[model samples]
Target chain A: MSYNWNWDIFLSPTPSGESTYLGWLLDGLQWTLTLSLGAWIMALVLGIGLGVLRTVPNRLLAGSAAAYVEVFRNVPLLVQLFIWYFVLPELLPTTLGDALKQTDPLAQQFFAALLCLGCFTAARVCEQVRAGIASLPRGQRNAGLALGLTLPQTYRYVLLPMALRLILPPLTSEFLNVFKNSAVASTIGLIELSRQSQQLVDYTAQAYEAFIAVTVLYVLINVLVMFGMRLLERRTRVPGYIGSK
Target chain B: MEEFDWTSIPGALPILADGMLITLEITATAILIGILWGTVLALARLSGNRPLAWLAAAYVNLFRAVPLVMVILWFYLIVPTLLQRWFGVSQSSDIRMISALVAFALFESAYYAEIIRAGVQSVPKGQVDAAFALGMPYHLTMRLVVLPQAFRNMVPLLLTQAIILFQDTSLVYVIGLADFFGAAYKVGDRDGRLVELLLFAGAVYFILCFGASLLVWQLQKKYST
Candidate 1:
């Protein structure tokens, strides 16, 4: 009740006098968006491949994909981020490790976070992709093969088109999760939105305002994503199946 | 390029184990509180009272939209001030665990509510009608007839969420709480062995989560049969 509210702090420059505090937050937002979008793209591509592998006739391929999902999904994202940032360089071949370590600190942080988020999310995305494929009737696969298509062609033309549509909704949630989970990158010092807000609170001593703004920004991102996904879902919807309107 | 010094890790087990206990405590409290409140939110959303339903939906949506770390920070920073004003708490460090608990529970309820709602809806229309025809009130029908069946179907999902909550307890590190991961980091930093300690922590997390997932898988398999 006694705390001072400072709405004007956004326009104030940082202690180092480079940019306004609002500028700091916007930069952080940019990092979050890029990190998450980059991760989502990687996750989607890898997830689809691994997902297909899990459902494939080759037991070896399916087994390896399953093992990948288990390893990635079981570890916490924060721990995975740590492993990427801290442990990875040491384990690599010396020249490569030294090259990675010698990169600009910001690039190092960004790449580490990107790799961690991409792989962690790919695991979840793989599960959804698997579920989506499994939900399709057996006839879909059989019919495609019966039409003289090879397994690869059957998957490309017959399976993926329908399975991707079926998974649009769950995939959207995973996409949103990438953004939310990107906040963990701050632990390794990425200066993303959450970290920027924490910095704002630390500098200005205005905890309530800092967090309220960050919370609103996050909600806005969620609303925009859900709205966009709804449009995608409506367009791709299959007849007689339940879907978002 | 230095060889991993395995010496310090054995000495730190007691400390790490202490931290792990705290981690499990937070996870257990959050799971209990999250499920209890999530059930209420689910019921309210389905309760058909417009104002109550809208409020419940808004709570769930607002929490779901934000990152868990933000919620944890908000509670850690803001609640202490409120508590100071109302309860005259001088030192706030002692209650960081409580703050983390409240944040996780509230944040988790949103996800759990959606799950519970779907579970409740999955129960057949005939079941609700039969309960009503037997002269049961709406609340009793839900409590006695609908929820039991819904809960049976929800066990595996609820366990999966619990596993996630267990993993997420690591986020308490943001507040400087010395949970298992935090303990590992600290000891690692102190001993100049960050790599070894982090690998150890990640391994422990993997073992626990992988084991729990297998358990959940078995439960789901049983349910399907």
Candidate 2:
């Protein structure tokens, strides 16, 4: 194909001599992992709350939850990321805004990315959570309520435990999506895995090797995540439900 | 502190609309090509031939595993060299647009493949058997009996994906193509109104995507009923 494929560039140090290109990629991987994991945690907590809210008997809570999901889910994620990174600071109180604007640039980027990816994914997660809960028989909720549990207790005790297991497979997809979506953080200059690959291309002029390396890293992450989720599903499976038996 | 200076927006609408056209063009091209190629991949995954199925599965997995931004960059950086070498196409903007289009189609195809595969699976086993009983060939069985039913069940999903694709065209901004979001960003940056332009763009995106999803929900209800 006439391409000058140099697999060794990764071993060579950058002109600045601080670290090798491989080290650069590892550094990028660290940020990617941190951003995605933090966002996942946030998405889970918020999504569960909103999802639970959507299914509750209270019209206000359900309507508000639906509103949150629609707003976050509808916008393109890149746009949301941009708003979080570029526009958010301006809307804050002046002193607070200045404080945010003046923070360590990387931290600022990371926080913005975390918030954007977290909330955007929370919207999708909320839908999955709502659907999971809704798929349960009406008798389960009614049974819980009749047995002297409050609504929130019903969720914590009777509803979520069962519904979460039922929805684990779909939840796995949403989890993987957070990792994938974290790549968008690079656009706001987070220097995540994808950004590092772009930097490598600019520096080394080996676009194929750089992108291939990044692609493999991403696949590795996806594989690891799927494997982990599969393990979780097995551990949490109740016999006679969802092919468990 | 002060009210949003939407003053620049009035002057920028024409350029933004130009950018929106590019966005729509990219989205349309990607959906058409992605669905077609995705169906091929779906069928291959369901094919009896082991190696062909494996190859298609591997391709879909690889694409699905990676993020869209990376795919956009991969094509943006990789394809231009080939385009320039073979077609003598050297305009950077044209190359970027083409690369974005290719990237979205290829990436979206992987996703569409999974959706289409699920849709195909949703068709009951008896339909294929009955079609075979009628002496229909494999292709005709898929065409006349299975795919129509599968596609009916899939329309809602396909529309959902298309909305996603429409939203995703914004990711081409990574390559510096002035799609709607990119154009808004450029104007905002130029005018020192990045916040206003971005908020405006977000509002526009919210309205369109939200509207489209509601329509899909209605379609889903109809089909399910």
Each prediction's RMSD over C-alphas, in Å, is: 1.5, 1.7
Per residue, candidate 1 scores C-alpha lDDT tens digits across B138-223 of: 99999999999999999999999999999999999999999999999999999999999999999999999999999999989989
Candidate 2, residues B33-148, lDDT tens digits: the string is 99999999999999999999999999999998999999898887778887878878666568888889889988999999999999999999999999999899999999889899
Candidate 1 residue pairs in backbone clash: none
Q: What is each predicted model's overall lDDT from 0 to 1? A: 0.92, 0.92
Cα-lDDT of candidate 1: 0.92
Model 1 Cα lDDT, one tens digit per residue, A40-69: 999999999999999999999999999999
Candidate 1 residue A171 C-alpha distance from true site, Å: 1.1
Report lDDT (Cα) of residue A125, candidate 1: 89
- Residue A228 in model 2: lDDT: 96
**Candidate 2 per-residue lDDT over residues A1-245, each given as its tens digit:** 68798999999999899999999999999999999999999999999999999999899989999999999988999999988998888888888989878889999999999999999999999998999899899999999999999988999999999988888998898999999999999998999999999999989988888889999999999999999999999998877785431
